[model samples]
Target chain A: MNHYIDVRTQIPRARQTINNNNIKTETEGGVPEWAIIELQGLIQMKKEDQSGPTVVGDLHYFSRNRHPVLILGHHVLNGKEVKLEQPMAVIEKDDTTSYKVKAIVKKKLLFKSRPKPIISNVSEKV
Target chain B: MDTCPERSSEDVRKIIKTAKLHESELTEVTQILRFPDPSKQNDNLKLMLLDDNLLKEIEGGNQLIFKGDPDENAVLCTSSKTYDIKEAETSNSLLLVPELLFAASTGLDETIVNKSVEGDSDSSFDKSNTSLNKSADSDDGKPPREIVHKDIISTFFTYYELKPCKPRLSKLIKLLDPTKYRGPELEYAVDKSKLYNYEALFDQIQASKAELDEELIKIQAIKIDDHYRLLEFDYEFRVLSHMLDLIEENSWPLDRISKDVTIDSLKDLVPESILEAMFGFYSSESAVDDGIQYYQYKQDKVCQFLARVLLKSAGKFNLTEFLQAWRDSVPEGMTTDESLLSGIALIDKTTTPQVVWGFAESDLPEDINQRFKVLFQTKAKWTVDEISPYIQLYATEKLNVNALLTKYARASTQDGVRVFSAKHMK
Candidate 1:
């Protein structure tokens, strides 16, 4: 039996599927910024079967940006590389959904430190 | 209270001292973190966009300014560019925590903590922290600008974006999952080995197949030979039976028997060695010699068989009756005289003589005298010319006996010729 959920109610699951499929993102929500993107726009895919641009719904995309690229001859992010622009569709908290916008790939000269990875469940021996 | 900043001015100073970043490096670090409303900052900017996530270097030394989130992921960024959080805690950029919000929480906390706990003054900590924040946050008052320096920009984008070049799909697929793309690689490895093992195996199989085929052919040939030999034996038996039948049906004359009974003429009846074994009457001195001994051996066998056949048919034989019978038996193409003589010669040693001549000088003389005595009794005296006809009557062939005639007769001159009369006293 196929249990299908409305995409509106299933954004997190949808996002999980996209992340598992290895699409790139630069957004905090872990989604790209475009309504339709060339399937080739995702770094992980070879050329997908369809020739024209694919709507964000058709794409396997996520805001999780672990996709890798070679930049100035170095592997970054635990030997992973990321591409910043890919198409994504995200459902907001109120169930309103937004498609990705076209983003110009530009240099972010003012780089900030990543937040420390925190382990949550340990107690102090007071 | 929810957005608590955990860093202190003393920690920031420590990072600066470890990295040896100059005052300008400190300013760049401070500016990037001090966007009054941190929540409103661009998401792309907040990404750890540099390879080492170090944004810039201060001029005097190895000090580099790095950026990362400190509390959310606990990356613990430091000014030392090569530091990894999982590997070591020492980093020069550790002080530049984005969560610190260089102006509000961490700065004030450092001032209060310094005054209460240690000999360090609140006034001195406030001076450095406030100066760094003022220079950094005052740059736009509008929004934090994207970095403009080429080296800094290039490093950030290189880490964050894919280059605009195509990569080979086959190579890319292999790189993605090596285990699945195994066919070509396995074949290539097998080909590169020097043994040519598959070819060798094929050759061995072919050789074994050829040997089996040869063995099958040999067996077939042996079977054919055995079959042919049996057929030949059967044919010989048939031919011998036919020859024996031909002999029994015909009253073969002596010469006809002689011609037909030779080993060469009757070869179809039986092999030469089998014929010799059956009817041979003489032993040859040398088996190797196709010479006179072998010829005589064959001739003797033929004559013996004929004599035995003739003797069997008629119980007892006399010369006159045998002569008549042999004359009738002579085959065409041979003279009657020659056939009779050869037959007599063959049977002579085995048979008794027919004519008796007692007290004879020789058979020819005794024969002549006997004929004269009989003629003389018929006529008391006769001319020599009258005796010629009677003398020829007993002679089997022409004989010269004119000189012997004087023993039986007396001669006188009468008219112009001579006449002879038998002497009465002798």
Candidate 2:
């Protein structure tokens, strides 16, 4: 319980290794690479399928749109790129000295809207 | 395709140059998101969610730490504040995509590859061949080269949320009890553990650095030979009395007491460092003259110390006798108010002699329920204002003093004044 959540060494180093990350412009840079795909309900799958490499969905990014679209099986759900109101620090407690910040996630890929069914309407050639 | 990238948060991308439709630039990239292999899905990653204010402090480069005992729930600490760390569970899967591309990171540059291949995602199928990419034309109508794939390294279903709370500092007193500095002369007599320095105390005490520093000041703890040492009660009272005597001997007005003057006079009597810190405790800075800042001996602080000194010696005294003695003990021209005794001493009229006894708040448990038990044990009943200081430390945004009283103590009007007594009185 007497532990430290060390961010001093991690956060300052993350700033220089920036990959298109811009936080508050004046404050600091963004965290590179990491994001959370926060689904509304549980991404429940069958027990048998859970053991294998399961396909969650396909994320489609379109130019000029604020949010992206995700295709899961027969369902097409629009996902928004949102900054989490309270940013979270991903902590990894290794079996030794202290807890370290693995990554800090500022923005998330939010898939909250009701999924629209991808109804195929292609006309068959005779 | 088998590599897990150079960095932990790397976003690996791959592109397929499928046949292109002329004139329409289909820059859209469809990425297949999948779960990692079941063996790789370890719930080792925990998110310590930060509030906006605390987030700002973190960004400002403050150290965040957590402290607790084995059975107690751990508390997190920033430089200035402490917070209760509560694990919140989410029904939805928190797909921790360390390299998931945000809207801003996915443009112009080829830092990311063709989006069909998920870098950390599951390799159950050939992602490049299943080109959901029907059209493959750049803005220049050129077919792009290749594709890439990546897997999610980890995922989590719960996160640690923080709520600001009073620093749990009662343990500090317990830790320092054995190592009390009874002056340099008596240091060899008692067997003690290797003394706790600031760093050691910080590691042991369940409080933030700034909060802990303030508590040390309030506890009047002084540094002797780099170790934060609490002065023994008798020794501390001796020092306090000497400091008071120096003020009277020099004929210096309370407002004009100089650090240089106190240091020069008390150097042989008390260590200079102890003298300086004690002055800081009993006084507040008023103004600077000739580059020497003067401190007015704080009236309330001095009076409280003197009252504690009187209350401790007598253990318990008839209310009238204790009041007179307390008044006589303080420096002349300074007055003592009963309100100053809020957390220091309690005057009980229920007793036959109506005695006033020392009851320092620092000795009580930091817990809400346990503290109420001790309060009720000390005296059967307490008026609202009398017990507020003792209980007020636990008051948070969701639970204020009145609300806490409602839950823990039964209330009734005693002689037109609201009084609180333990709910299940023994």
Candidate 3:
């Protein structure tokens, strides 16, 4: 059977474990601190008769306390971007050293490109 | 007989003074004897002095008597001697024995007593007289009023005089009494035929009530439906009328006649396809002596065909609501390709109306027309990859893509496509 890895769950778990002790740092002075964690997860897509597993996508992560955080790069990765069927999260053990992820894998479908939002001219004050 | 004729004056004076002293002592004794209890002494004295009975007792004494008739003569006997009595008499010849003196004094006392008795009788008579006078004063020609002992008594008498005496429950007893002829004869006569048809009358009333209720319910439902329909129609009419008006004014030809048979004249003709595409764009562009008119003419033709094809689709949906939303999305002074695209996207998201995609250039806003022209050229080559981003942007921003698509598609075929050829192709 083919086993699928939930990229959303793996990304947050890796970030949480890395930022457990280290304080967030910022690139510019006077700017609020932000935490960035690069997560790489190997998602496998196995065929029914194939003996080996095929990698689907890699997971990348970055976060800030406030502001719009970009989760995925604009470019496609291997003909696909890391997308999840459902929102997922990582669960940490009481000892805080290890992590376990919980996720659901639903039926996969072709991903449509996110449309570029049009910028409309703001209407003049009447 | 009377040998010793008279005593000396000095001896008579001495005798009178001694007798007077005895009389005072006897008077004191009589007062004491009258009442043994000293507390009642005043009462006893008043009785002896003032009472006629005491005087009468004194009159019965042997020393006092009437000489002739009792009623005519008043005399006193003194030691068996008689002396006349008068109102004013002062004479030594009237001297008498001490017992006779006391008795003669009693005679005067009796007269005083009799006068006192008469005075009392007069006083009592005055009291009775005053009472009688009061009774006579109270009589004012009206009947004597009797005091009522109880309020019920007065009320009963008043009710008796004012109204006929009858039992309070007479009517009720008459209604229930078996002795009285309280059967149908005494009751209001009901028609037997009407009573026999009671069930039919009841059925008729029930049927009428049911019909009334149903009619009321229908009226209420119709009122509500009409209210919503009016609102919907109002919005529909506003948008549809506005679109038609704008198209007719800006898009249609003003010339009444086609002057020349030229390629330019062909351009002036409105495309039938575009006309039939939607109800709102029918009069947008006018036929003119220009190449754009040919596109308009062709568009009219295409629109006509689309109208037939989409009649069922439009019927199933509220085209009025869709048009209103489309018109509202296109803001004022936003006569641009991007604006039109945004309006189309809005309509698509809200109304989800089906449309064909392309571009056009006419006597519309210059920048938007040019953009459409550019996009049309690119779309002709089926290079959607280059235009997909713009389309995506238009879609995401909720522009009226349907209008843009129809307008642009007509503009691209304006040069070569003929209405007759397009009709055959469809």
Per-residue CA lDDT of model 1 for B1-426, tens digit only, reads 111123233333333322322222222222112212333323322122223132221111122211112221112112222222121111122111121111221123344455536653322434545555454333323222221111111101111211111111111111222222122223244323222222222222212223323432322111121110111223323433344344445544322332225555566645554344332322233332333232222333333333333444433457566555544443323233423232222222233655211111111232555656755554445555455544533332233334445665666656766766566645
- Of the two candidates 1 and 3, the one with more favorable lDDT, higher being better, is 1
For model 2, the DockQ equals 0.24
**How far in Å is the alpha carbon of B280 misplaced in model 2?**
2.6
Tens-digit lDDT track for model 3 on B312-377? 233243445434443443323322232333212211223356432322222123354455555443
Please provide, for model 1 over A8-107, each residue's C-alpha lDDT reduced to its tens digit, 9 standing for 90 to 100: 2222211110011113543342323221111111222122333322111100001123111111101111112223333112211222221122122221
lDDT by residue for model 2 (B285-369), tens: 8888888888788888889888887877647789988889889998887899999999999887777888888898877877778
Candidate 2 Cα deviation (angstroms), residue A67: 5.6
Worst 10 contiguous positions by lDDT, candidate 1 chain A: A54-63
User: Which window of ten consecutive residues has the lowest lDDT sum in model 2 chain B?
Assistant: B14-23
**Which scores better on DockQ, 1 or 3?**
1
| Runs in model 3 lying further than 4 Å from the true structure | A1-126, B1-396, B402-424
Chain A only: list TM-scores of all candidates.
0.16, 0.62, 0.19
Provide the DockQ value for model 3.
Answer: 0.00
